[model samples]
Structure formats: structure tokens, C-alpha cells
Target chain A: MTDNKYAFFIGCLIPYRELAYEISARRIAKKLGIKLITMPDANCCGLPIDPVNHEMSIALAARNLCIAEDMGLNIITLCNGCFATLTKTNKQLKKDRELRQRVNKYLADISLEFKGSIEVKHFIEILAEDVGIEKLSELVTKPFNDLKVAEHYGCHFLRPHKYLETENPENPTVLTKLIELTGATVVDYLDESECCGGTVLGIDPNIPLSLARDKLKNIKEAGAEAIITICPNCHMIYDLNQPRIEKTFSETYGLPVLHYPQLLGLAMGITPEELALDELRVKADKVLSRLVEEIKVKH
Target chain B: MSNEVKTYRKPLRIDPEFKNLVLKMPGGETLKICFQCGTCTSSCPIAQIIDTYRPNQLMRLAQFGLKDKVLSSKTIWLCAACATCVDRCPQGVEMASVLRVLKNLAVKEGCVPRVFKDFGSAILKTGFVYNIPKTRTKKREDAGLPPLSKTKIEDIKKLAEKTGFIDTIKGEESDDRQ
Candidate 1:
């Protein structure tokens, strides 16, 4: 009855590498009075080979979307790649009669159909629009005002650019604003919109890593206390591979990265243990613990 | 057409942006062999759509260390991730994927030219990732769309889990923030 029940589209990354993010999302949603439903049968948003296989990607995203339509529910997704790919495909299929006809022809064999009932959304927009930042502010029990953070937006999530209208894609601040609402200072960095070289990692890793090195260097140089990410793939390279990248370069750029969910959860007073901030590949170690102590001491 | 030919300087140099972008590919080390044999030029759909690129020139910049030129070239943005060029390359370079990597670089560099954000957000709300149906798409036939395979949230979640898709999804929320 409009009472905040959201279907949590965990996608792929958090359950495995960034499980902390999932924990954070759930905990934060609970605090905000919005229920995140982790439904069964939620398969891939079918974003595999999205850059290459349009039809295949659409079909896969469609399959996911179709299920939600069947449920008569609105979906709130966590990954920008899945969010962008699924929504873009649906919009294209819906608006372009010809493309839709072709996609539908492919779908008929699989028994899947595109019903626009499913509204693909980034958690930020929903949080901003549906949940509202004002409400978010109300939920903030402890803001980490001492922390300095940089926001990184992955390519699939926002670059092709006209789809996710929550902010100006070029200089987006949705995450920064959300973080700011938590009383933290948004750190500035020249390479904030930099790529994580995600697509290249699966195929030829060197090219991707080399690309990632550029941004990692910038975030480190920016003196950011932490780097916040919105996509799982981006987190993997930046959060998990930063060590490997530094090793390859014969240097060290030890920076802690957090998913938006985790950051929000932390600020909302969710305990570090409950949010599982300790589970990341890069390890929160001194980062969160120290931040927590600082807060506790200040209080 | 004949009169305009006179205004064309012997040959307008290749887009400066493409030149540099070619050098920026993470390990885009082999980008130099492409001499615009007119083969890629003849095959590109983007070139057909927009007259701003020549695959040959773009290939040339890859070899010359023109990183910014290549990255900023409209050519990189125009690419639709089609594998035709990769298939056509005599050097066996995975051009499509390479360009995609470059495009990803471009996006990171602030090249979200248009329509990418809205489309992404739309899919997040509904599982479809797009405007498959406006409200409650109960009947596929109603929208002249194909009936979809009935999938459960768990099925998609598993697929996402198998692919480590959660990181990708959550990252989007974090990355796109202001």
C-alpha cells in the first residue's frame, strides 16, 4: 500500500565479492522503512556481452523484466550496468516498433515478452525520488562528517547518457549528495568519472588494468579517505584489483572502496558487523573501524 | 559536390581525438598496423551513419601514440560494439572489444553523450531495463511483444550471482553519484 516494500535486485557482484554491499543495502533499507525483497528465480539481468550482443543482452534483460511484470511489482536494481542495459533495451523495444518486432520474434520462441510495467531504476533515483533524500536525512543516525570520499560511476551505468535522469551524467552528484546528506565532505577528483576497464577485464585484462591504473592513481592522489562505487564490476577492478594493479606498477595505492549501500548503511547507524563491511576483498580493516572509533569518541 | 571538392584541403587530417584514443587502450599495443586500407572504412556502419570517421585513420593513430585524439574521436562514441571491424582486421586484433574498452574509457572520461543514463534508470525500477510495458505488462500479446519466459527472482539472482553481477549493479549506484 505504498508503504516501502522494494524488491532487491542483488544482481551478481555483492553476493560473492562485495557481499558487504548487499548487507549494507538490506540494513539501510530496513532502517529507512523500505523493505528490499530478495526474491527467488532472479537470474542474470542478462548483461553478459552487452557491449557486443545487443539482441542476446536484450533477451536476457527481458527475461528478468518479464518475471517482475508477472509479479505485478516494481523493481529497484543495484547495478548500473544491469539497470542501464535492461531499461535501455526495454525503452528501445517499446519505442522502436521495428526493433521491438524483431526482439519479440526472438522472444516468442523462448516464451518471453517485454511488458514495460517493470521500471528499471538505480537505487539513487528511487532513494531520491521515492524514498526522498529528506527521508534519508531523517534516517541518518550517525553521519561520518570526517570522511572524505570520491564517487566513481561505471560506464554501463551512466555514460551512453540519456537514460538515467537523476542527475547530469557528465558531472553527476546523486551519490555525492546522498553521502553529503550523511554529513560527510565530498572530495573532488579530476578522474572521478574514469573507467574501471570492466569489459576488457573478462577478455584481455592488461588493457583493462592499464586503463584502471589511471583512475586509481588519481583517487589516491586526491587524498580521498574512501572511494564509493555503484557497479559490481567497477568495484571488482577498483576494490579487488587495486592491489594487483599497484603490484604490477611496483608501487602501492592502498585505498578503501565502499559500495553506496554500505556507506549509506554505515551512516544510518547500521553496525559494521551487521553490514558485513569486513567481507570485502580489499578489507575495510582500519578504515571503517577507525571511522567508527572517531565517531564514538566524538559522541 | 564538385565545387565543394575544391574546398577540401588535399586531405583533412584524421580526427585528432581518434589518434590519441587509439593509444589509450589498456594494452592497445598493436593498434598501429591498421593503415585505413579502406577495408574498415568500407565496412563501418557508423561511418555510413556519420561521415566523421575513417577506420583507416583511426587505426593509424593507434600506432602513433595519439591517445587523446583517439579517445575523443566521435568515432569511438559512434561505435555500436559491432564485431565487423574485428572480423575484418588483417592483424587479428579484437577491434570491437578493444573499441568497447576504449568507449568505456571514454565514458569514464565523461563521454556519456546522450540517452545512456535514463535508459539505465528505467530498467532498475522494472526488471526489463527498459520501457517494455508501461505499467503492468500482463499480456505479451497485448503489447505486440513476445511472451517472455517465466523467470523467478531467484533464477535471475542466481544468474547475477554466478556472474558477480551484484558488484556491477551496486557500483553503478556508487559511481554515478555526484
Candidate 2:
């Protein structure tokens, strides 16, 4: 029985750009009794080039699916982009025979075949569904004590509802409910479903900077101490670009952006070192220090 | 007062087959069904922030068979692919997917944005957009995680050639070096 085992597919970003996200996710999954088996030879999830070449995008995603099928385990993706492409291609291939035949023919060159048996899920899905919020709350050693944080629902996690039915597109409650389990309050902000604008960062970076600045403006106005993100790309845009956004917009909003995994790890009583929280571009010191003070009084 | 109807005209070249051409492309079949309601534009996150990116106008251009104008505009490249507009469309018009089709068409027509071409070349060469630096590998090792794996370059190259990606990026590689 493939009960809790998952073929972990960490796309390009987390391994290089966002190590803290990967570290915390692994540490938390271990504590939750879930097994994540890394597929070493997995390539990019093909989202970065989806617009340029649809065929290449689908083929790359199919190759990863085939790799997971060989292990006889479902996929658990860390990045939202990976989840979108994998789920989209998996659904497309299962429903469209011609597409399946074409992708399989391409895979034949690499000695792989996509059978479409394996399922692809975001790490949040596994947490919300498999772990169950109540059990997650029970495992929390240090609650956020009403730390107000905003949730940035990265685009691919909830949209294209025909394929991704995990949450409502307009107003998602899964990420909010999961955050509540950490004892943190999800602050409401404008355009919560707003794109992080990372997609156009390369074409015209100033646009994303302004967009991120706008989102941060709303986040700060809502009195959020930090922002929580599901996708590394969003995290990079928000966390890594906070200073740049400040420089560009001539404002100061030092809102710490944490990956949901990092926040969950903190509540699970995992130390900062284990989660690699120190490596975050925007420091979570204010939030972490508050927790430290609360823990001191509790003891 | 002169009671005359002054008809002003500017030359417009419309390709009646352009709409059909777009319909034949993957994700472009629904190009004709868009009612030009501006819902896609209003719902688009990028469109709201960036004044130049108008999804509704782009759709109109596509439907009008303004091939050159529709494909060359920076607006098509500005869509973040958030799917908000697609989900919000009352007519079930997959605006994001249609935009993808337009972007691919733009590339074949040799009007792709410089950034996209650079990203494509990087993918063609390494199978990953960005190379994982040695410092990053050390950090991953410190965190008790396995180092990032190297992709099978030969297989990726084979797939690219079959998908015409190799040809798309043929001359662009040398141009990037300078």
C-alpha cells in the first residue's frame, strides 16, 4: 500500500534560490510521518517555457510523470508552478489519447513511458487533506498566539479550476485554514488572489516591482506582521524583492515573508537552524523574536 | 454649413484567415467566441497594474485579424498567466491559454521578447533556466538536503530537436555571448 509515501519533485527554484523552503518542508514532513522520496534526475517542470513552446512544456512534464510512475507513488510538489504543469499535463494526457500517444512517443526516445497512474499534488494539499488541520493543531508546540500574517495564494495553486479543484478560485479557504492551524490569523487584503507578477519579471521587471510594492502596501496597511507564500517564485518576488520594492517606491515595509512550510515548522517546535530560517532574504526576526518571548513566558 | 458626410479612412490590412489560423493552434480554438466584454481585462491582475497590457484589446486585435499588431505588442507578454481572467470570463473563454497560443505565434514570427529568447536558450542548453551555483549546493548540503541533481543533457537535447526548440534557439545562442 502506498499510504504516505510520495515522489518528491523539487523544481529548479527551491534547490537553488529558496533553500529554506525545501529545508523546512523536509523537516516538517518527517515529523508528520510522511515519506518524501526525491527523484534525482527530474528536470524542470516546464512552466518557465510553457508560453514559448507548449509541446516542449507538456513533454517535460510528462517525462517527470513517467519517472514517478516507475516508483509507483504519487507526486508531491513543493513549488506551485511544478504542481500546475504536472497536474495539467497528467490530466490532459489521461483524457486525450492523441496527446498521450504523442508524449509517449517522445518519451520512448528516453526509454520512459507515461502511464498516467500517478497523481500530482501540492505540499499544501497533503497538509490540508492528509495531515488534517486538527491533527496539525495538536502537534503544534508553539502557536503563533495570534500573529497576523497575510497569505499570498500563488496563481497556479488554485486557478484553472477544470484541472485544479483543491480550492475556490475567487476566494480560497484552504491556505487560510492551514494558517489558522498554526495559531496565526490570516489578515484580509486587497486582491488576495493577485498574481505575484513573477511571470513578467524578465520581460519588464519594473512592472513586477510595482505590483509587489502594491501588494506589500496592502499587506502592511492591513497590519500584517508577515506574508506567507505557497510558491517559491512568489516568495522570491515578495521576500527577495522587498528592499528593491522599497527602493523603487520610496517606502519602508519590512514585512517578513515566510513559506508556509517555514511557519508550520516553527509551530511544530522545530528550531530555526533546522528550518534554515536564517537564510531568508527578508528577516523573520521580528516574528521569531515575538515567538521566543512567548515561549519564555509559557515555560 | 456643408451637409456632407466626411468619411475618413486609414488603410487596415485584415487577414480573414488569421482568426481561422489562430483557431487551428492549440488553445486558440476559442478565439472567435470572445464577446469583447472587457471582463478579461478587468479581472487581469497585471492589466490592472500595467496600463499598457489590455487583454480585451489584444483579443479584439486577434479577432480582427490584425496579425502583426496582435503578435508584436508587449501586452501579450505581460500576462502573468494567473488564470483569473479565464476563470472570470462569462463565456468560458480561456484567455490565458489563448494568450499562450499568441505568445507561441509571436515567437515563430520572430517577435519574441529578448528575455523569453534568453530564457529559451538557457533551457535548451541546460534543461534548467538558471544554473544552481556551487555556493547553493554547499548551502543545501549544510541543511542536510541532497544536492540538486544534474539533468540528462542528451535526452533534453533530443526532446528539443523533436519539438523544434533547437531550431527556434539555433542562432540565438551565439548572440547571447556578446
Candidate 3:
């Protein structure tokens, strides 16, 4: 049986830019009886520095793993980048004694060691595997039966399938299945598994913008009233940068982008205000109003 | 108009030992396995939009032991590290990891990008990639969220120092002076 307690590893992006994701995630996790103990003295997950120094990246990630090891809890991260980096590092250090000793040498300076006794999981993984869909379905008091949305898994969540080993990266159904659990219609769009180009946004903004434009176009054309994303970077590319993309392409696609937790939260009878729905760049009034109207008709 | 035909110049030299160097790195174990099926390039989202960035060509360049050409090229930095290439490679080449090995070599050669240097320094200072502003941290309480965890900067610095991250960035600074 999987543990209900987790060492919360809130990566840089969520605290810095994507508060709504964290806000909703904490709410849903609390509602599900998942105890989150804030990991103290956690550093960056080491993705940004991976390109410059692979060893250093591994060491940084190992440091975070050591913290969770100290806490005696499995690590749970909100960001896909953090989830992938930490999970890969944890698996690598566990299997490779040489790599572990190398990273442990660095950790020794900080008075820590990577025993690799703990596991790392993304928040969604816990919900699906530990919480179970039946429990989630039972908790839903206000299912959006008429809501239609597209799901973006983002690259780091499932790709590099060898390391992740979660779902088929080419045609992932985990996120789609989770979306369906909220009683929302999951619209199948062209190139459903495409990258959001967020990873390259720092190197070249135009590439991600073009990629987001195409995704938004496809999502819109498929009759999705909104787009759902689990990764903060993908959310930034779609929701935060949606206006920038529309302006650059001289097109119109004002599709609301919701964090999966926000969608699930709404389905569980959580109010939009509690989910921080107003913080979204593109207004979700259409989805929100539909929910309100559904309640009115029921009353 | 003077008819000046610009001749394409091949790389002056190739380091045959470079493949061995890549093979020694953590993610470079499968460097010799790539058969250049172009699956990675076709699967890449960045490559789909940016014609100049191709993963298979980079893999081929590294496989051929063209160290200088592969390390100094800007295209090596273009990989988003999405791992689509890594997953789709039928040869089990792990293209993303191989690209990271190339990037690490480039950083060692003092060809580090400005943004990466900024990221390194930021981590050293704040323990996070982007520094969380004090105002934002304070606002967390208003949002009914707990205070952000304070990172032990001294421990991070020690880890960074022991890993030679300090030296790598220092090496880049010295390169700038030259």
C-alpha cells in the first residue's frame, strides 16, 4: 500500500509564477486525506543547470532526495520538471553504486547521504494510484457533465519513458482518464501529445509561441471549451502566454486553461474563489457560468 | 558585381577521442548505439518548428567524433531536453542524455550560454532557479498558504563547491577575460 504522507517538494515555478496550481493542489490533496509535510531546506530540482553540468544537476537533485530520506517520506512535486529530475536522479542513484558514491561525495560535504530508500512521485500519480478513481468519483458533488476540454500532459511528465516508466509517452491516457473522472468530455485533438515548447522558451521565445499557437488552434478547432494542463510550464505557455500568441499570430483563441486540480476541485463542489480561478490569464467565465447555471437548474 | 563564390569550408579538425570522452560521462553510455534513423528529429517539437535544430544530426556529429564542431555549435543548446528523441530512438540511444553530455563538454570548454550562467548564480544565491521575491512570499500568507520553506544556502553552496560547479562558472568568467 502506498503511503498517504508525502514530503512536498514545491519546485521553483509553482511558488514563483503558478500559485493557482499550488493553491488548488493543496486543497485537493487535503480533501483526499493526503498529508503533506513541507520539506525543509529543499533546493532547486536541478533541471536548469542540467545543460551546464550533469554531475552538478545530479548532485543538486540528490540533495533534495536526501532531505526526503531524512523526513522518511516519499517526495511529491507539483512541477513535472521537478518530478522528472528528482525521480530520474533517485532511480539512478539507487541502481548505480558508482554514480551514487559520486553524488554522495558531494552530499557528504553537506552532512547528507543518498540511501535511496524513498520514492518520488508527481501529485497526479498519487491521485491516480493511491487515491483511486472510485474515491474521486464518489467525492464529486458537482460534475461538469457538459464541460469539454483538452489535456496537455507536457513533455517531462511522461517522456524519456525509460526513466519515467509511467505511461505510453506517444499516446498517454492517464491525464485523459483523470479528466474524464471529473465528468468532463475529453476532446481528442490532433497531435495530442505534442510538446508545449516551454523548455525552449528561455533559449528562443518564438519557438514556444509557435508551438503554443498550434496547440491552442487545435484545441479550439476540436471544440474544447478549455485546455487542461498538469505542468506549470505548459500552463504558462498556454494560459499565461495565450494573449501574446494571439497577438503575434493575429488570431483569436481565448480558450480558458485550467490546472487539472482546479477542474477536479470544481467538480468536488469547491468554489471558483477557493480554486483561485480569477488568477488565470484567460477568463474561465464560460466554464464557471455553466457550472453556476447547472446548479441553478438543479435547485 | 564581383562574382565571389563562397566556398563551404569543412571543419578544420575532428577529435577522434571525443566519442570515448562522451562515453565516460554519466548519460553517454549509449553514444555508440545510434544508427541515425532520424526518429528523434522527426519527433522533436522544437525541431518541427525550428528547422536548424535537429537531434539526429547532433547525434551523428558526436558519433563521428567531431568534438569541436559539435561542442561549439549553437544547435546543441537548442534541445529542450524533452526526451521525445530519447523515447522514440529505436536504437535505445537516449538522445536527450547524449545531448546533455555534449552540452556539459561545451560548458567545460567555456562555451556556456549567458542564461545558464545566470541560472547557476541564481541557485547559488537563492537555492531556487528564479528568486522568489519577498513581496510574493509575504502574499502567500494572505492567500492562506504557509510560509515558503527557507533553503539552507550554506549547504547548497557546500554541495555546489564539492561538485566543481563553482569552478565551472569561475572558468567561464576567466574565459570572458581572455
Best-fitting candidate, scored by lDDT: 3
- TM-score for all predictions? 0.63, 0.94, 0.95
Question: All candidates' lDDT scores?
Answer: 0.60, 0.83, 0.85
Model 2 fnat value: 0.69
DockQ order, best first, reads 3, 2, 1
Please give, for residues A74-158, the per-residue lDDT of candidate 2 as tens digits.
9999898899989999999999898899888888899988887989999999999998888888877777775899999898998
In model 3, where do residues sit more than 4 Å from their true spots?
A: A292-299, B1-11, B171-178
Better of 1 and 2 by lDDT: 2
Error at A286, model 2, angstroms = 1.8
Which candidate leads the pack in DockQ? 3
List model 1 lDDT by residue over B1-178, tens digit each.
1222244455434444554554454324446555545666565544553455566665555455455555555555445433345545667555654565565555545554334443333334433334444332343243232233333444334333433333333333212211
Q: How do the residues A1-299 of candidate 1 rate in per-residue lDDT, one tens digit apiece?
A: 23476555666544435555655666666676777665445555756444422344556666666666776666777777677767777677667787667656665655667767656677777777788888788877667756777788775666445444445555776777787887767778864655565644433466457766777777778878778887877888887888888889887777888888887877777777777676576776545653443443232
- Tens-digit lDDT track of model 2 for B1-178: 0111112143556788888988998789888899988999888878777666778878888898978777766567888888988788999888989999998887787655566567677676667787777888887777678766667888888888788776565433222211
TM-score top scorer: 3
For every model in order, the fraction of real contacts preserved is: 0.04, 0.69, 0.83
